[model samples]
Target: MYVGGGAGNVGGAAVTLASRAGARVVATARPEDAAEVRHLGAAEVLDYRSPDLGEQLRRAAPGGYHVHLDTSGRGLLADAVDLLAPGGRLVAMTGLGRGAAELPLGRLYTRDASIVGFALSNAATADLAEAAEGAVGALGDTPWRPRIADRLPLSRTAEAHRRMDAGGVRGRLVLTVGAADGR
Candidate 1:
């Protein structure tokens, strides 16, 4: 398994989930976050910004990855596809960088590889419920936990957004509903 964007919240969770499922997950993260992503259970964490990212990934799983989950939203499908094994599945959990992209149909078809786009909004209600239930059930046994870097009353929501937009937030900012004056 190859999980891209291992340092982000979703990417981090993917690492934990894939690892807990007994997969040998190789994840991509910022150079500064490599160690932490590894601790999250990635067998190897490569720097996404490296000029030789694809090469490193290939070396990490020389046989090719059976699954590639892209959380980076960096239009990495081409790179991901090149790293896939026969019959591999690519899950695009976020943006493909733009509106359209050309597929390498010949290789894709020949290898029986597939690309799937996933979003909570498009998920079936039952599937969502099942996943929620599974998450609730698995919480106790998993080491994964949502990181809360800051807490502020609902009144400060804009401030939180500003911080996030400015890339100042390292983890989720919890907004607690409270009085208008922010008790």
Candidate 2:
């Protein structure tokens, strides 16, 4: 399996969860974040921006990935589709850009590959609970903590969004509902 955006908040969590699930995770991260992504449990961490990303991905798992989770959404669908094993699934969560992104339909269809994009908040509560339970089960006795990159008060909500838009902030950007002190 492959996890894109392996260093970001959601990606980091995905790596950890996927690892705990006994999957051999090959993930991509920025050069600086490679260590943390590896620490989170990716068997191999590659630079997402590498010139030969396709080659690297192929070399990492020549048989191809059964599942590709794209948290960063860097327009890797075509490349991912090329590397999908039979009946592979691509879960693209972010970077659903306004402009059209081309995909290799012939290849995708021939391999019986499918692509899906979803928002976690849109998931049913029952499903969420089930996933949470599974995450806990996967952890065994290990403790888990979300990777938080920044914390801002509610008053700066717009600023937080801007930071997210800029795509430089790493991990989860936590926003307090109010001031640090009760207000």
Candidate 3:
């Protein structure tokens, strides 16, 4: 299960990777992003804004999600724990403005589940290079591709940041350097 499907950066990659690995992928996003999430290989897309989101998720994956990737990190760890299968793992990649969310220690221990935090910044350079190489190799044989919402010139970097900060920017906002002709 992937949280923040609308972001389309980490969440989109999670959907593609999980599906490619033969997992039944489920994602959460705004209603407008449902179709896109499905296109990214989600077997089920739940509207995160719905009041009955928990119930809907339960219905969608009755066996419980074996893995949960939380990209928004907006205090969803507790809920994800409740929806996890025994010995399931939840990885959180981002938290932005959120602070100090409560974790259900009792449930986590009882279910034998685990929550892990990840940050690329802390990765070793060699590991990063290896992962990058693997990603490039995989791209050659897979239908998975990064979605680019907009490509802006380097001069418009501030504008790009503003657009991202305003939310609703799907995929990535690319900043083009130098000339388009590879000069």
Q: 1-183, model 1: which lDDT tens digit per residue? A: 999888888788888888988999999888888888888899998888888888898899988899999787774567778888999988877874487766677777788999887888888999999998987676546666776798988888899889988975777999887675556
Candidate 3 TM-score to native: 0.86
Winning candidate number (TM-score):
1
Q: Write the per-residue lDDT of candidate 3 for residues 33-151, one digit (tens) a residue.
A: 78877877788888887889889888988877788887755537788889988888878777756777778999998989888888899999999999989877755465567879999
CA error at residue 152 for candidate 3, angstroms: 1.7
Better model by TM-score: candidate 2 vs candidate 3: 3
User: How much lDDT does candidate 3 score?
Assistant: 0.78
TM-score of every candidate relative to the true structure: 0.87, 0.83, 0.86
Clashing pairs in 3: none
- List all candidate RMSDs to the true structure: 2.3, 2.6, 2.6
Instruction: At residue 64, give the lDDT of candidate 1.
Output: 89
Most accurate candidate by lDDT: 1
